[model samples]
Target: MSYISRLGSAFSKSSMFASEFFLDLYMYAHYCGISPFQDRRNKTYYKLIIETHAIEKGLSLANPRMLFGRKKITEIMKAARRYGIGSNDLPILMATGALQDYLALHRSAGLSDPLLDSIDAFLKDRATASAVLGSGGLRHYPDGMPSPSPEKAALLTSRFSCRMFSPEPLDAETVKEIVRIAQTAPSQCNRQATKIHFYSNRERIGQLLALQAGSAGFAETVTGLVVVAFDLAAWGGAQQRNQGYVDASLFAMNLMLAAHAMGAASCPLNLAVPHSTERQIKIVGEIPKDQRLVMMIALGRPADGPLKSAASPRRTIDEILTIRDQAVAAA
Candidate 1:
């Protein structure tokens, strides 16, 4: 090849790469929760959740300031009203619970602050919202951590993406147990932002599976659908933008494992759709607008007789691992 031809080809490749990188940035700018071009309703709800969680974190602190988060509480109230957050929304309920605990603690200590009076007034106006005060506040843990289990490897390797299922509907108690196990998945800063929505209705499962598009062959066998999502409000700053997906993915993996442990079959379904299709999914699935969908899970009891799954192999340790010790002793 001539030198000029080679140079021309290199320039063309570099230009194409640059264009693709900029396209990624453009998508991030428009779709991220912090973006101004994003939906206003979602943004407002995200702000409310973020502020509410801030209060929860403050309460959980080892040494929290008595009057800390006064500004945050004010912002929470503003966002709640701006977005018309329902009284029963978990974030609103938790915010009210945190405020109530704050008020009770300060008053019992004989402390005086104008912020307390404002909180008192706010709580009085929304008295109905205080129903969940017991559900959200911090709890005392007299006992320490539980011991680790010995069946880790057996449980992990035995689980697979189950495609065939029995027609029997999964009971409500089993679904709850699976979620309870999955909730133990760790998150950044103990935020616990993952949310699971389970649909046991056959018709609804079919509707959701239609949008997922990956469950075509086995859709008829699916008796339950699980939507795993993470609240975007639990994150802040540009650096933490993608953390929600990471946290939710961890939760989803745990959920699949939990299903397997409980003798229920589960297959992880991908939600790699456009923004418009995601909106449609949220509407059909009745998921909150501020939560980003991580993936869907098709759940059911395993069908009788021999079950079959693809032999999805893993790379050997050497193929997947890299070791750098002291930079090879400066060889």
Candidate 2:
């Protein structure tokens, strides 16, 4: 039996191994800083069975007397061996199953907001990111919940990617702290495969901005640019298959949210600058050649116009959240 199927079977089983195995995988993803749902669309068939089984097992966990036993766990292992481990079902299956207990255990950590904020950045339309610093007040949650803002819904309602920039320049330390905030982004298996490039050169900043803007018309007044990326060497040039890019990207997104929280406007850039700019950056900036540029951010005060930058439109949750016919059985 394949290792994946064994894991799936273990996870899908409505008995002891179900939630416990899920909990293990959840911790692993958390440590790796990967979103459980972020890329599951890439592998859906293997995931379906695990997700369906997890729900059934979760129900059983609630009521031990009915269909909940070691024997059920045995079924899950058997099923997993048959189905495989890297299944798309693993993400949701892990999410909806053991995650509750996992969240319950980590309730004190309050890491959920940053993680949720990162997910929001990926799902929402973003134009750019920034390097602004936050006041001490910004870090404190007025009413501490496992969510963002004084109201739990603040994460959903008020969070947005910042666009536009002022002529002002942020201090190097401020940029350092903003990157420092990103430094906390979880890495896969604690590999910490990420790095940051701080750009203060107005000319270079404008160049990147223009390339991303599709014209020389990018906000010329912008003063800060930060390149978020991952160091391939961190993976030893062999762990490429470990999927570290997703981890770094998610970390960068969280940094963008933290910047917004700190009362600064920013933009996320795709770094499509010409090879010349890339070479200049590599030479002058001393950037590692193997690091993959995950994303870039332009940070500064908002220079107001007709509001050239606003939150782009987003899909309804219903669009992003599909209800598989069987997964909806709980509904």
Q: Mind giving the per-residue lDDT tens digits that candidate 1 earns over 1-331?
A: 9999999988887777677667779999989889989999778756766676556555544344688888888887677656543455555665666677778877987989888898888777667544434234444323221122456587787776667677887899999999999988999999999999999878888888899887756787789999989898998654566789999999999998888888888889999899988998999999989999989998888775555443233334765578755465654
Candidate 2, residue 182: the lDDT equals 65
> What's each prediction's TM-score?
0.55, 0.48
The Cα local distance difference test for each model comes to: 0.75, 0.51
Predicted structure 1: clash tally: 0
Alpha-carbon shift of residue 271 in model 2 (angstroms): 3.1
Clashes of each: 0, 21
Model 2: per-residue Cα lDDT over 69-150, one tens digit each:
2343344333433444323233333322332332232344454544334323421211122122111011112322212467
Give the TM-score (vs. native) of candidate 1. 0.55
As a whole number from 0 to 100, the lDDT of residue 326 in candidate 1 is 43
